[model samples]
Target: MINDDAQTRPLFNKIALIGVGLIGGSFALSLKKARAVEHVVGLDRHSTSLKAALQLGIIDSFTDDMASAIADADLIVIATPVAQTTKILSSIYPYLQSNTIVTDVGSTKADVVLAARTSLQEKVSQFIPAHPIAGREKNGPEAAIDDLYVGKKVVITLLAENADQSIELVAQAWRLCGAIIHHLSPKEHDQVFASVSHLPHLLAYALVDDIAAKPHADRLFQYAASGFRDFTRIAGSSPEMWRDISLANRTAILEELDSYSAKLQQLRASLEASDSVALEAIYSRAQTARVNWITAIEAAESQNKDGGD
Candidate 1:
């Protein structure tokens, strides 16, 4: 029999990571960082990815089969594309232990919660819909870093079916990964990210697409500076992933797109009329708002660090 101390020491005896890309890879490394889990078994269909993760010491073991990987895992993290969650969760449902806890690192949560509800039925209490508001344009196991979630905002979308213990464990795990937990309903999570995350990505893709369609586009891009690169960075993100997020949060994203379109039309009108005051007002307001946001975030981070110390 396992020692009582050993059983209680590990936050989880084994953590089964369903998708060993950036998020999932980072999660494994983070648990190791905090000494939270005794073992990690990572799953990815990519044989090369599994090998690389094992070589990098990101996982204790790796596998491609869904059911066998999660058979005895106490915690399951499904980090696949948002659109794949339903299918993946359904496939793994039969193998999950009744005491196992499930969570996802999807960008959107409303549909994820729905997927869990429909797939797990009465066992929905075992799943927690979570989104870590962090990532780069780069993905895959190679891009994973241990500190990626440090000081990041992790939103937990509270569901009616979620049990108190399940919620606490999910929240505590994120905290162990050095994230600050925030609670929201699935609807609220989707709406908030649709504006702040999805809308910006859509704008970036549109801007790049329009720029590329211009005559002598290559010449124009050759002269592009930091401002262009910074604004369009997200346009370089995975097309498959963004496509899923766009459709998954379609209603809220469409609302944001329409609002942005109106703003663009207003800016165009101001430029056409050569309204210097209006243009300056828009620029000044944007600059002020962004600077204020940065300042507030920095202050919060400092406060959190100080409090932790």
Candidate 2:
């Protein structure tokens, strides 16, 4: 249901998308579907992606020129990899409007915040760091969907210099896209995601790589079951993106890796000693914890659904 009222008085007159990948294209489509933006301009190095976005009606126009893309745009979304944050911010800094509100969909926030601080300097407040906790094992503009963020968590990590108005406007933009907004400090965001998100992806990739390197790799894959597929589903994600994310949040990820390694060691010791009781105890505790977590999430989702009505 498109809101005609919102169309008549959209939140943003023009929004410039710096990358026409899954996140950027989805944002454009979602905003347009909600009638919360009058125009979306895509700016990406890859002409193919921009063309695809334009053809799909994700963006009203496409451009490779930074100045043309940012000029008069009320909001700018940097949807590139975390590795490109500094470069993108630096490129757009010269063309940013006084009232421009810049945000990103980067997976890691601390590095992005540092990049914004370095590139935007005195105007750093204009760039708010955000991480949308929604994605598939896919990439590119063609993979984008308008409802990708529906009911998903989008974390906004604020800078001390950010004004109240700017913060709310950014939050409202995500709200229009049907995202539930959450706030966290940059350090907190990175640390939390490093444990839960980054580590899982890393483990999945590692597991697949380990299996694929064996002489019986073909035989193993041939007989692989649903559990293998489910566990390694995220291993199919873009290597470039995950590489950048892992490097960007290496400090927190390394700490998490060490903690996880310690736990693995404990499990290995239990197995070596044939300690069935200890192994069963550990598995029981983990099962109980996961069940509680899932129950809490389901309850929250139900509450949110009821409230939405």
Candidate 3:
């Protein structure tokens, strides 16, 4: 029951956030701060996260029952892990209002879009698939912050023409959360994120596993430096969530993994041959690319802030 006068400001009457973890809690905080939602209700399988969200005042009310939580929600945000999207959708599909707009924060889009299309075709027009490219190694409601998505990228994948209204509402929601929204086809979204997001997670997991498999693993770990620590920080992310993402985007991930393997083999050959020229070239290219990417990201953030102002 948000103020009716706020209705013209992209604020919803009620927002039901399913799975109140980091993303869900962040959404709630942003909505409250922006006065975008009159009331926020939450649902989560974990009692600890639900309690933390409540303690943080991220939600007005919460429940374990999905239907009860989303009954009259004008906006429904599915913030569960990618694998849980279908299951959660099934549980709440029966309770969704006709005009209720649903969106997700899952990393991958194809699987989620297909799941919604198959299970809730009648309401699929109200469904908008989105992925907020903002997160930290830390998770749970306790780690949530109001500015988590500030100056970050949010991808919205719209497959059906009838989803225009839902897409606009989803974009407005992210805008209120201080995010820049980009529209991409589900296939394009999966392919792009497979390399940028999925592959990085895989690399982090593999790097940690490789280090741990060494004969003197403890000795190696003891000597790990800032670079090693920073690169592997995401390896600390929820294994259950990463496991789902890895499996869901298996095709694209495998392709990228193969490409990475080839590069690794090339570097190994160069090192074995004492090919200083090749090594220097590879290192120099990587350094330049990293610098350029950092510059571009900073510029984007600046532009986003300016636009908001």
Per-model CA lDDT versus the true structure: 0.88, 0.91, 0.86
Report the error of model 3 at residue 50, Å. Answer: 1.2
Q: Specify the highest-TM-score model's number.
A: 2
lDDT tens string, model 3, 1-309?
A: 223465575478788888888888998898788878778888888888878898998988888777777788888899988998888888877888887888899998899989998877688888888899989888899888998998888998886645566677788889889988998998899999889888998899998999899899999999999999999998999999999999998999899999999999999999999999999999999999999999998997788789888
Q: Name the regions of candidate 3 deviating beyond 4 angstroms.
A: 1-4, 7-10
In model 1, what lDDT does residue 308 have? 64
- Candidate 1 segments exceeding 4 Å error: 1-8
TM-score of each: 0.95, 0.97, 0.94
User: Order of candidates by lDDT, top first?
Assistant: 2, 1, 3
Order the numbered candidates by TM-score, best leading.
Answer: 2, 1, 3
Summarize candidate 2's per-residue lDDT along 1-309 as a digit string, tens digits.
123466378888899998988998898999898878988999988898888889999999987788988888989999988899999999988988778999999999999999999999999998888999999888999999999988889999999999888888889899988899999999999999999899999999999999999999999999999998999999999999999999999999999999999999999999999999999999999999999999999998788778666
By TM-score, the better pick of 1 and 2 is: 2
Candidate 2 versus truth, CA RMSD in Å, comes to 2.3
Query: Candidate 1, 286: how far from true, in Å?
Result: 1.5
Locate the minimum summed-lDDT window of 10 residues in model 1. Answer: 1-10
Residue-level lDDT for 199 in candidate 1? 98
Task: Decide which is better by lDDT, 2 or 3.
Answer: 2
Q: What's the lDDT for candidate 2?
A: 0.91
